[model samples]
Target: MNESLHGGVGKAQIKLRTQDFPIKEFVCQHDPLYIRALFLQAKTEFLLLSLDLTSLTESMVYDLKASVYEEFNIPIENIWITVTHTFSAPHLDKSYPIFIKKVKEAVQLSVSRALERVTKLAISTDSVTTSLNCSRNIETPFGWWLGRNDLEYSNHDIRILKIYEIKTDHLLCVLFNGDLPPSVMADSYLEQGGKAVSSDLIGYTCRKLEETVTQTAIFILGAAGDQRPLEKSCEDIVSEECLKRNDLHEAGFKLVETQGDRLYEEICSSLVKPNPIFLPIKAISIYEKKVFLEEKVMPIPTKELKPTKHFDFSKTGRQQELTIAGVSLGSIVLLGIQPEVNSLFGEKLRELVNVQTVFIASMVNGAIKYLPEEKDFERVTYTAMNTQLGRGSSKQFLEEVRRFLKESNLSVDKQIN
Candidate 1:
């Protein structure tokens, strides 16, 4: 059950631009934003919906989950909703009501279509490396700013989960995971008076893959709180003659195409390699827990042109809770963590799990600011300053994940015996 609809188009009445950058209007539409869903009904039913938006609010998540449960008998815990984190799309607030209604309708339609075309599933996992993303925390004298920094850590692994039709060998869905957003590469267009609302790199990559194969491509964002795409420098932009009439837009589109093409080629190369050993279908085990994050009043720097006063910072409130959810799919485990997560936490979780495959889907339930590692707070990085969770909170969340995996594995073993 794969279908896509126009999320929205045209300039939004209200714009919540990324990094506080302003845009007068959305000049063009590169491609239609899609709400893609893939439903799997095995021993336990599961539904995964992917969107081309930046983020969804907690209330929206609750409403969507309730609606899905009422329409289909799927449990709230079994429904996993995620966003691609593309910055070019309109603010969910402005697109709300209508946008969310369309999404709900799409989900219902997908589920109905899925029931009609049920097929045996074969799943496999594969990953490849690409130079698409880099760390965005620059170390400055004031503090760690949110800018492109070559020294900071970045995650480059593009993990892919492929589901296929058992008899026809046709690909059903391809879930690709990475820690970079499509807007990273095309941000320059916004600076150059480009007003096009595009899905950017993620959309390009998905489109290219769909063109190559007859399958629905779903993108799942990883720990990308401190990550961004490797953008073209000013020199590179000048070399491309972007100053000439609307050439900036053309250059931006070209950049997206080149990056998307490279990613598609990498995925194709990995797919052609020896197929991964498929894991057996087992009873799906779902675990969910909410950890209360200690709230703290962080000082925000003043926006004055010059510091005339002694006190240049003001206090503000941060997030107060973190929701973690996990679903066991045989050898593969899907962990969904609310809010933006740093890559280091995801890396640590993978090390602790020591599993064949672990999908850490970040910004799952809602957006609650950044969740940086404990050590990162010492640097007072942008993520650290913006985070609601205090130091060692990441460790606590990791422990919860570890426990869930261990208990789930034991449960599976006992059932087998």
Candidate 2:
């Protein structure tokens, strides 16, 4: 075995406040979600355990990468972070200086804790259940809706894993699936505080899951760019309360208090087996795919067009996020792609990779908008503008993936081949 290439192991943790009271909503309302940083260190690698604050923004992601990289010596791609898409949390973008300061400090503290935690732990892999889910039920004119109007469709299979210690049996991390979109509290009044924040859901789930086992379980949201719970109902209320330790705010704080203990107890009893150790840690590969672009500015229907002409998606659109098939290995075989991929993409990638257990994950690396089917592009829905990335965008992205796979020397269809 290469001395420098031993198994990469790491652990980290951070806790940020998930509460914010922005008296009024702004044009860029900060999605309320607690941002937790889980840092992991293994051999020569250092990764940041990022929990979400509402949804992820390209600029914010870039900021995190830059800050973490500058503070700690690590490769950019190695520092992976994800959001829980909690809507009821605090918004760092709010104008209230106090709110912003509180959030910044909270994030910093979490980051520091993560750095401290990562240096003190070992890493073991374990698989958990793919539970606690259902497709988003949007009441559309055409009846209940899930994916875009695209002819191609796909289903999301939520996956989760635990990263923890060997001796003390502390759960240092959790890797889970699902998009953390902050759509749950779409119409929440800031003072009322009943906005849906996903971080609490993840944190509560993790904390509860931890009690069930001996380790800390952190959640990494899966391909949920397009997945969101419809309406802020009792279910969401119960889910959010799972994370509240105390009723600080007068708002939804009491929501979690109602059955928080009961739910936590339930999670404690639902302990599953841990993931197996990752042997002979091989290589990690990343690929970027671009959805094709349209040469001509697709004209919008007169009725659909906003008077201001801002591409009124209320009228028409196309799929925004698109990528070719993928193959990854760890606890299971992962066929990854992005931008709310069609169900067919997962099946096709499964065939291409030919793994024993194929898991399809969307929004793995970065998030594109949404990728509708070609036919939907023709009809021009709200997603069409983004999905139509010109003529050869999809093909170009495929080529990029092929090149990345070959260069990285990651295997595909090892069993079949």
Candidate 3:
């Protein structure tokens, strides 16, 4: 396939999320968050924005989409905005109007710069298997807990999308999707009594990769509902009994550095590999479908779940209406999902779908909670309880995705693996 790929890649650094707070509240010492944009044009336009933040609300995404559309004349569906799911960065709250403004400005600037330098592109795809994360669903005396289950499943394969400037064959941007959450320092605190706002895993690694290659790199969070970093700074990642201060709060940055180093090395080694396609994309079709999910109700007596965060399910509505969105770039489809989908169900999706590759942005647009498979409900795992969707929600969502894929002409009567 041969075609010209237009658009460019750009990034803008973000100030500390807690910069306006008191001295004790300041979190970042070294690493800074960023908003990166990748705008491409084939048959369908694509403007993908990757944020080094935790999450984005549905309403916020809508407004951001509108702003990008106003600036770039791109449709809302063609704009894919996603987060790194970095726990180190503080969530956006009502009081952070200044930071919000900064974010909005950064988005506009990044996209504007990208549009100014629009260039033809060539693309290639590759993947590297990793064990950086393990399933965080463990069975204990008290039901399934949010802990390391080393023997359990995780999306070990990191998908790579390398985009290059066709004229010079210079790497312009690289998008890598991994299953690990950038939360290695999620619970780490400073010795002087403050939390740090480092980029954690994905952001740190991406920064390193960009510096090494002298190009843009974006981190897309993959299906990681049941996955967690094997190297966490907290003591109780395995269990509450895992003790107090498993890692020195101040030295937790070292763990993050190590995690980032491991990830960076893996990707750098595979930056250019054997037999890459480097094909010019033929076309792109952005598609989405609405799915209404019922809130889960336990049928039997179970231990009360202590979730880390509780989203206002009621605010969303009586039934959760999530979208199964995708950007089909010829044979490849980039899935943009709001919730953290279980790795197994994500695999099921790959098996059922007929696309050459399906790289799922696990937590995009919004964070509803984890969506585990129907069989996983029996495990009574933390994901099962933490999630708002009822049993079989994952299955229902898979069906909806399949239907949408067929409707969009992105799938055929074929199976993958």
Better of 1 and 2 by TM-score: 1
Clashes by residue pair, model 1: 27-195
Cα lDDT of model 1 by residue, 282-375, tens digit: 5566777776655555455422211112221222345476777777777777878886877766676666555678888887877776776755
The true-structure Cα RMSD of candidate 3 reads 4.0
lDDT of each residue in 1-417, candidate 3, tens digit only: 244667799999875444465423454555788899998888778889988888888888888899988977888878888888887766766576777777888899888878888888878888887778898776654456666779987879888888878787788888898788888887667777777777788888888888878478998888887888887777553444532236578777788888789888888777757555766467777887788877765432334444322222222235788977878776778878888887777777776567667787876766678776755666656676666787767767777777777887777564333
What's the C-alpha lDDT at position 69 in model 3?
89
The candidate 1 region of ten consecutive residues with least summed lDDT is: 3-12
Q: How close is candidate 3 to the true structure, as a TM-score?
A: 0.90
Give the poorly placed runs of model 3, Cα more than 4 Å off. 17-19, 22-29, 237-247, 297-317, 412-417
TM value for model 1:
0.80
Candidate scoring better on TM-score of 1 and 3: 3
TM-score of each: 0.80, 0.62, 0.90
Models sorted by lDDT, best on top: 3, 1, 2
| Local error of candidate 1 at residue 131 (angstroms) | 1.6
Tens digit per residue, CA lDDT, model 2, 1-417: 111122222223323233433223422233233455554433445343445454445555556666666766556656554455455554455465565455445555566655554333433333333323334422334323332222223243434444444444555555555433433333344344433333444555555555555444445544443344322323211122231112333244333333334334434433354444433324333433344432324465533431121342342234343444343333244445544543443344445443344454554444554554443344443444443344334334444444444444444532211
lDDT of 3: 0.76
Of the candidates numbered 1 and 3, which has the greater lDDT value?
A: 3
Q: After superposition, how far is residue 89 of candidate 1 from its true place, in Å?
A: 1.3
- How are the candidates ranked when ordered by TM-score, highest leading? 3, 1, 2
